[model samples]
Target: MNPLLPIRHFVPDTEARVMPDGRLYLYGSYDISRETTYCSDILHVFSTDDLVHWTDHGAALRSQDIPWASEGHLLYAPDCIYQDGTYYLYFCMTGSYEGVAISDSPAGPFHHPVPITPADRDSIDPAVFIDTDGQAYYFWGQFHLRGSKLNPDMITLDVSTLNTCIIDEKNHGFHEGISIRKRNGIYYLLYTDISRGKATCISYAMSDSPLGPYKKGGVIIDNINCDPNTWNNHGCMAEYKGQWYVFYHRSSQNSKFNRRVCIEPIFFDERGYIAEVPMTSQGAEPPLSAGVPISAALACQMMHGLFISPAADNTTEILSHATNGSWAAYRYLSFDAPKSFSITAAAAINGGTVEIWADSLLLGSCLVTPTGGWDIYRTFRCPLTPVTGVKTLYLVFRGNDLKRRLMDVKEFCFYGDCGSGNAD
Candidate 1:
C-alpha cells in the first residue's frame, strides 16, 4: 500500500536511483517514532526489483559514525549515487552542513564520511546526476539552487564550474529538495514546490542545459491529507522498466515527525510535461483486493484528529483518536461482489457509528461499541449493498462527543469473490 515501508519505519526525503544490480535503491533520512521535529541520527535504504516488493537494507549510515556532525541526532535528508565501483552517499546534518560517504554496495554500511568544502552553511539535500558524457553534476541549497561538477574523487566539487541561482526560488515555487535527471536531451529538475503556503507539493521544471534558466513545468504530486500537520514533500522521479514513477513521503501518527516513504506512477505528455497525480491509498500497488484484509495504515487521506498510529507491537498501526465527523479514505479498492463489510476496532466511547461508503454508494454502517480499551480490538461485520466495482472507500465516523476519540480501528476486509494479491 501507499506507505511503502512498515508502519514502524518513518523514512522521508527519499532519493531514488536505478543501480547497476538492476534494482531501484531508495535512500532517505530515518525518523524516530517519538520525535516531534524531523529526522533522527540514522539513515536507511530500501531496494526493489519489482515496485511492490521491497527489501530494507538497514542503517546505511548513523550520526555516531560522523565525528564532525553534532551529537543531537538530527540527520535530515540524503542522496546516494554509484560511481565507478563505489556508492557515494551524500547527507546533510543539523547545521545545514553537507558531506559524502562511500560504500561498495548500493545499500551499505557506508564508512569514512567527510564534510565537503565549497558548500555554504545553508546547504541541504545534495543531489548527484551523471550526464551522457560521463561527467557528474552536484546540486544543493535551500531557496537558491546551486550546482557544480563533481571532481574525479566524487566527493569534492569542481569550484571552477560552480553555478548559482539556477532557479528563481520565489518565482518558481522552489522550497528545497532538488533532484535532477536528463532524458531526450532535456534536463528535468524536480523539487518541493512552495505552493499551498508550504512545501507540500513535488513540482518540476525543464531546461535544455544542466544548470540554467529553467522553465517551470508543473506539479507532480502533493502530500495533502497525509497528516493533519503534514508540511513538506521531498523525493525524486525514477524510471523503471520503461515506466516513470515519482517517489515521495507522507506523515503518520497525526504528527509531522513520523513520515514514511510512498510512491505513485507518473505520466508524461508528448511535450514531456508531467501530469499532476493525487495521493492514493493504492500507491504503486494494484487496486486493493476485496478478499484479504487491508491495513488501516494504508489510508492516504485522513482528516482531523484521526491518524495512523504505531501499535504496541510496533509492526502494525491503528486508526486512532477519531473524533465525531473525523474520517479517513482508502483509494481505489476493487470490489467484486462484496457481501459483507468487516472491521476490527476497540472503542472507549459508547455511541459511535462508522458509515461505510464506497465513493458515495453507501455500502453500510455499523456501531462501534466499547471494547474496554484502545488496545483491545474485536471484529464487527455488516452486510454490504452489493458493491462490485473499483472505488474509493470512505469511513465517515459519527459520534455525539465532537472531540473525543471514539475508537481505535485496525485491519478490515470484505467477504466476497476475490483472489490473492494484485487483480488478474
Candidate 2:
C-alpha cells in the first residue's frame, strides 16, 4: 500500500493533547507573518470530536496576557499537563527557559508568572510527564539539554535533584524537543537529531526510571522523502483508542513555512520496544478503528504546496513555477460526481493561479490569496470534479510577477461519497 499524503498544507509550532472529555485539542502559534521578526503571541485552538472534521475554537491563550513576556517576543512550543483539577500550560517565553501558567480547563485563560527554570540555564521545549506514583517531571533542552523533577503541585521544580539528560552523540550533540512516556515499567525518551540536515532523524533512548541515565537506541524514523532537507521533529506521542501515534512538524516549502506539523502511526514491539516509524514528507494513513469519525481536523497532516521558492525570471518548467512552494501527488482517488472539499494555506500570495487537472485534462483554476503569514490557518470549501479512474490530481501555480509567494497547506477534507476503495 502507498503511504498517506498531506491533505492540507500548514500548521505551525504544533502542540497536541487529548482532553479528559475524549476530544483532541491542538494548540499552536498563529498569524505569524513571514516579514515580521516576531509572530503573534496568540495560541489558536482546534478541537476534533472525530479526527476527520475540525471545529476552530479561536485563540485559547495570548502572550499579551503574560506580563513576563517582552512586548513582541514569540511564544514558542506550548504543552499541557492535566493534574488534580487544573491544566498546566508549560511554554517557552522569548526562547529562554520554560515557564508555565494554570487554568481549571484545558482551553484556558492561563495565568503566567516568571520563568520556571533559571534564565542562565537556556532551557526550552518543556514537556511534563506525571509518573504512576504521581510525581511530575519536567523535560526541556535543545543543544544544552536538561531535565528535572517538579513538585507534585506541578508549579516549581525540585532544585536539589536536577538531572542532565543524554542526547545522541552520533548527531553532533544536537538534541531538543524531548517527549517522555512510561510503558510496562520502562521509560522511553523520544527526541530530534537535527545534525544531518534533511537527513534529520527521530532517535530514541530507554531508561528504567522517569529521570534516568537513558541509553541511546538507534533511529526510529529516518529521512522523509518529501522533506529532503528537513524531516519530522518537535512533536508529542499519544495513544487514542488503543493505538499509538507520533505527532510532529516538518519544514514547509522553505524556512518561512518550515514548521508545519504531521502525524504517523506508531506501535511497540513484543519486546516492549517502539517499532520503527514510517517516514513520509507528505502524510500518512489514518489509524484503524480509533472509534472517532474521520473529521476535517484529521486531515491536518496533508502537505499543501508551501515553501516552494519562486521560479527564476522567465521560467516555464512545471516544477519551476513552484519556486516558492511545491507538492508531490500521491494515492490519488477518483469520483463520479463533484465532491465537496476544503483547502487551507499560509502566505501573502498575489496574482498566483492554482489549476487543478486530472488525466492531462484541465479541470479548473482558483485564485489563491496569501494569508500574510505562516500562522494564519485558512480553509476554503468548493466542489471538485474527479476524472473517471483518475489516479492523480495536479496543482499548478503561476506567479503574476516577482512579488508572488506560496503558502503551506494544512489539509483538505472531502465530504460525501466520491468513490470508495482503499486509497493508500
Candidate 3:
C-alpha cells in the first residue's frame, strides 16, 4: 500500500473535541475571503468517525455578528469542552483576547460571544481543563503566561481566585496552545513554547492540584524534519487503540502559508514523566502496527527531519541529517513501488539546490525558488536505477551564496526497495 495514501487533509487552525457519544467534532478558523487572507472566520461542526475521513457541517460561527472585531481581523485557535449538557467554545478574536460561545448540541448555532476575561491583558489560545476534583481552570497567553480559576459553569472566571501566574517568568513564558491531562493521579499541563521561533517545543508542568504551583518539566515534543523558523504549534493529544499520540501542525516547505497536521507517538517514563522525544529527520523505526497502512500523519512523524539553521553568528553547521534530525541512518526502506526517492525544500537563497545520490549515482535534485512563499511544500521525485551491488544514499545542500540561507526540508521518503547499503 502507498504510505502517503492514508493521510487526510484537515482545515487549518482547527482544534478537536470528542463527544461523550464517541463522535469527534472540530472547531477552527476558515479563510473565507481571498483578498486579505486574514479575513478568516470561525467554522464550527466538522466531525469524523475515523481519523482518515472528515464530514463538514458548515460554519457554526461566523464573523458577521462579532461587533468587537474589525472587518479584516480573523478569529483563530478555538478550543471547546463539554460540560453540563453544554459545549463551551473558547476562541481568540483578532488574535488579541479569548471569548466564548455556548451551544446545547455539539454542532451548534452558538450564542453571541461573551468575554470570559477582560481584554485589557494580552491573551490567546485559551484551553479550559476540568480537573479530577471537578474544578475548571483557564490557561492562556502568547508572550506572557497566565492561568485562573473558572466558574463551575465554565463560561466566566470565578474572579474570587483571579489570574494566577503558572510560569510567568520572562523568556520562559509560552502560554499558548495549552492542554491539561491527568494520567494516574498526576496532572500534566502541555503547552507550546514559541520563543524558539515558529518551531514549537512541547513542555509540561506537573502538579497534584489542577490549579497549582505546578513544577515544570523538560520538553516532550520539539520540531523534527522542518525548519525551526517555520511555524509548528497548536495541537491536541488523543489515544487510539491504547497508543498515546499528539496531532499538531507544521509550516509547509515555504515556512509560512501552508500548515499541515502531523502526529507522533507519546511515550511515558517509568516515573510517569514523558521521555525526551527525538527530533524528526532522525528517521524512526516504523511504528509497530502489524504492517497495516497507517495514517500519513503518523508516517510523517516517524520520518520527520531535524531543523538545522545558521547559528547566531550565521555560521553553517554541518551535522549528518537524521530522520527527525535525531536518528542517523545507514539504510532506508521505500514506501512506494519502483524504488523511488524524493526531497522537498523551501529556503531564501538563489541558485540553491539539494542533491541526492545513491552509491555515487545521482538520484535527484530539488531547486530552491523564491516565488514559492517561504512556507511552500514542494516534492521532487527520482526513480532509483537498478544496481546489483551495495548502495549508499547521501544528501547535500549546495548554494552559490554562502550568506543566503539554505533550505529546510521536512523529510524525504524512499520507496520500492531497501537496497543493500551502509553509511561510512
Whole-structure CA lDDT of model 1: 0.85
Model 2 off-target regions past 4 Å?
1-10, 31-39, 95-97, 119-121, 168-174, 222-232, 256-258, 279-424
**Predicted candidate 1 versus true structure: per-residue lDDT over 160-255, tens digit per residue:** 888888885787888999999887788999999986787899999999988776999989999888788888999999999998989999888778
Model 3, CA-based lDDT: 0.54
lDDT of 2 by residue, 18-55 (tens): 88888887765453423323235666666665454666
lDDT of 2 at 119: 25
lDDT of candidates 1 onward, in order = 0.85, 0.55, 0.54
Q: In terms of TM-score, how similar is model 1 to the real structure? A: 0.94
TM-score quality measure for candidate 2 = 0.65
- Flag the better candidate by TM-score, 2 or 3: 3
Candidate 2 global CA lDDT score: 0.55
In candidate 1, where is summed lDDT lowest over 10 consecutive residues? 415-424
lDDT score of residue 387 within candidate 2:
48
